[model samples]
Target: MQQPHDTPTLGKRAALSIAALGVVFGDIGTSPLYAIRECFHGEYGIAVTESNVLGVLSLVFWALLLVVTIKYLVFIMRADNDGEGGVLALTALAKPKQVRMGTPSWVLVAFGLFAACLLYGDGMITPAISVLSAVEGLGHIEPVFAPYVIHVTLGILVGLFLLQRHGTAKVGTLFGPIILVWFCVLAALGLPQIIGNPKVLSALLPWHGIEFLVENRAHGFVVLGAVFLVVTGAEAIYADMGHFGSSPIRLTWFAVAFPALTLNYFGQGAHLMANPQDAFHPFYAIVPHWALIPLVILATMATIIASQAVITGAFSLTSQAINLGYLPRLRVTHTSSTHIGQIYVAPVNWLLMICTVGLVLGFRSSSKLAAAYGVAVTATMLITSILFFVVARKRWNWSLPAAGALTVLFLMVDSSFFVSNMTKIFHGAWFPLLIGGVFFIVMITWEEGREILGAKIQGLTESLSAFMDQVLADKPQRVEGQAFFLTGSYDRVPMAMVQNMRHNKIVHSEVYFLHIRIEEIPRVPNMEKIELERFGSGIYRIIAHFGFMEEPKIATILELCKGLGIEADLETASFFLGREKLILGDKPGMGRLRAHLFLFLSHNAMDAAGFFDIPSEQVIEVGAQLEL
Candidate 1:
């Protein structure tokens, strides 16, 4: 995913493809549990006659073909930014190196950011619906189990969130095998019904879907809001492309996931056509009585794996946002030492848990939650299409006509789903909009506040060259030990250095100004990470380059410096970090309300020593008040 490391042998690709089943396909794989039932028995129910059944199945088939298969796997996945895919990664790809007025880049970037925020909405809804739908199967086992569904769901969700700190490495090994079994069961359960009625196979033709929309007119159009659920996790496939590489994901999809999903959906339609009375739960109705309990248990495990993938994705997304300066610093714990992508964001995990539990209590059924599912996904899909258009033009250098043509095709599909989803705004679709709006505001505020603060500091500070020239000319008294001043800008004197000169009145025998710069790419190779410059008189400047996915550690930086010929003993060194307090200056560009919010965020932000993993006893905090 992070650009090709090597040409993987066939055996390696096969293993990665299998492992990807757990993480990459889990969300889409679980769609069969509720997608079919929601279409026929949901708020926009259509009749389950043979024609209607095949028609609906046809729509699902084509949507999978057009959106997930053609659009994402073929086109959008190719827009990966250095082999990283996702709205945020795509945004970085589409963002122009230079800003120009009247260009559409700004709009594209803004839309992409909002789309990224909407994924949080997806994060909250997916687990609620997936786990809730699976747990509801208990009712099939016994009528008495229906009453305890909510309690059981809440308990499962709580337990899941609580277990995040322990990491996923322990259970991750079982994810691929369990999801494989779940998909197999999905195929097996639906196959008999499908085999019994070959007439349902006619749904593979495109005309059935068109006739479905024409026969029902506007009613069928609205039903698309439900049908959109089939491709709800398509974005996740693109997002996780960086995890297993696109080759493995593409191979697994067509070879394993696609066939099973296609068969199960056809099988469900066949079952529905024969026994329309069981339309409320055709998925469970297709299963043999003897396999019901085991299937439900397997289904529960599969859904949990689905939920776990989304939860961990939220953690990884949060980490990206933090490193990219879209969000404030939060505690990020790397769960797997071997797997760079396996991470834990506790704050994000707990917040998602609270929302997931609340959603289950509010909707109380997967059918109602289905009303809220597609709006965020469709909007995100639309945004991804727009961004992909930009990347095709700017990065790929494709012809304008060619890029526009493909985008138009994608837009037509995305627009239809988004407008259809708009009809459900009153019926619980408002949840994602409200949540995404708040997150968008926070992201915009954080970015704007950082820029304003940087400008303010720039106006009050001296250039590094000027400060170094003056210090060498003055020849101030020097101390024995080394001093490393953590700085934000490479070519400006750190606030801590300025304050140290004003208050402490002496320079150390060895002075190193360190700045950590996060690059847009997922990772910066270690060999190119450290940039050093000598300013004479034992004073130096060290600029450390980190990728958005990499965490900066001061200890590691020092160790790397030692290898780069800057010999300094750790025991005799002290790290100086600037601590800023925000105050509204006369030229405060931010509105009063946003300024206050930024103040609160800055006040509670993780300190430099903690975030950088510096030794506590060796860190010295230098404080200054900054007007924003």
Candidate 2:
């Protein structure tokens, strides 16, 4: 069941464009802080020569052009699931069905879920690293403030996390103008150096990238560890595409953000080449001393916006995961209806706050945190590219040769970055890997637990209509109104429904066997609404279709059903929901302790009346058997 409210239109295209510029561009916008500097001057405590600088800059530029502008913005974003984008949205469009009996879609979903979990690790690290790096600029001004850098960084991060509940639309409004000014300032400071050393422009040529790789060989490959920082937020672009349509994101990048970023990076490279001896930060060297404070403030704002984007992304991803059944349903609060993307999750927000602050404290400098930031982002990107290829050929009906050629080129570039970042695993990159591993375990456990429970229910379930006939024949009990039975499967109704009719001496004029299926797509078409099949003797089997992006509201659908000529009165309908209380008598695979704990947790879960949007007055709960 879904509610149809007025889809509040975002202002005009221009305002929507500005909003997109603010919210969607944060990840890519903050890259100028360290992308070029780290590539030229290795974060691994080594000096990078002039030759490697051109090559690294070339790699960053080309990676953005090929991967971000071409692959995602131009192509992948078009593969939206009813105007939504992301792994889950894509999965919905694909409609991945189980290949075998034991095999559930959860197995396939785990891959994307793992990627989502890894993004959480990235969300935690991005803020810590981005803010710390910007604040570390204070060190260049005076060494005395260095001691309190971590303290200030942590405080700002904590404040940002707390503000998430307030919704980003208020704070987010300033992001576009702030980032616009920051990029302009970035290019303004660096333009003079680019004009002086025009040869640095030669880095734009593809051969320069090749030459750097040929000459530096080992070091050139490792440059990816740092180059990855440039595109760390590339996935955010695709993930946030649903917020502001695909066209806006494409136009925003090619028209505004792209050229500004390129010039700024070139400016940074030009500054480094001209004044190799200057101890001044090349990023700040372009700016005058009088504007240093203002520049730092702008940088801080941009970084905060970047952190906020990832935080919002985590919330959206968690919401999607819950709908897809990879994770248990957690409490979700919609921050804004006008902007479906604006959401806040209590557990996710708090956990991110703790992890982010811990990272800031542990790795006080952005340089140290940078090593861990790119790995999770790059790994997710590579995985996305792989999935994109499958989608392009199989789903999009693209020719194999064309898809293969496009996929191979992107994979080489992305895989190189992934391997490059892999070298930094021991040097703090292991943090994201550790987080991803832990999250993967949680996803798998929850998924496995559901499978076992589903199987247990399947074995115990009895045919509702047949059992009803037998109960009526034996007991002849009669009651008023319609009875709705909830079951885990659509194939057969639960035994509880039959037992309740027989033992409790209750019967209704009509019995509706309801099966609610949540689809992977963000929205369901009107044609695929609710299907009703009458099973004789006033027994009707109703199957309701709900999209992953939709919140299931059974009452609302029943109201909608009135228009289709099937009258369902919620006030008179008695809702019968089965509750499986597990008895832990030594389950074979999941040991007694784990089963007992799982059973305890499952038993205490929110009742179906609230979860499924049924009125409390019309609800009837039946406790059933569960062997674990």
- Which candidate gets the maximum lDDT versus the true structure? 1
Q: Cα RMSD (Å) between model 2 and the true structure? A: 3.3
Residue-by-residue lDDT tens digits, candidate 1, 1-628: 2353144688878778778899989999999989989889998888888888988999999999999999999989888766778888998888976533235766776798799889999999999999989888899988899999889888988999999988989789889989888878777877888899989999999999999989998989998888888898999999998878888889888988888999999999999988999888888888888878898889888989999999988898889999988888887988888878789887788889889999999999998999988898899999999889988998999999999999999999999999999999999999998888888888878888988888778887899889988897888889988999988888999898899998988999989999999887878888888999988889999999988878888767877888789886666689998888778876667788888888877877778888888778888998889888
Give one digit per residue, the lDDT tens place, for model 2 in 1-628: 2221112344445565666777788878888787666665546522545776677678778988887888788877877766778766765554365522235644445556667778889989988988987887776566788788888888899999998887877656677777777667767876777898888898898887888878878877887788778777878887887777776677678777888888888888777777764323567666677887777778888899888888988898887777766666677787766667788988889999999988888877777777777788777877677677767876889999998898898888788888989988888888988888777766565666777878877776666656657755775556768888876677687666766855776666788788888776776765676878776666778778887777777876787677667788888788898877767664444655555556655765457787677899998888877676
On TM-score, the leading prediction is: 1
The per-prediction tally of clashing pairs is: 0, 0
Tell me the whole-model lDDT of each prediction, alpha carbons only: 0.87, 0.75
What is the TM-score (0 to 1) of candidate 1?
0.97
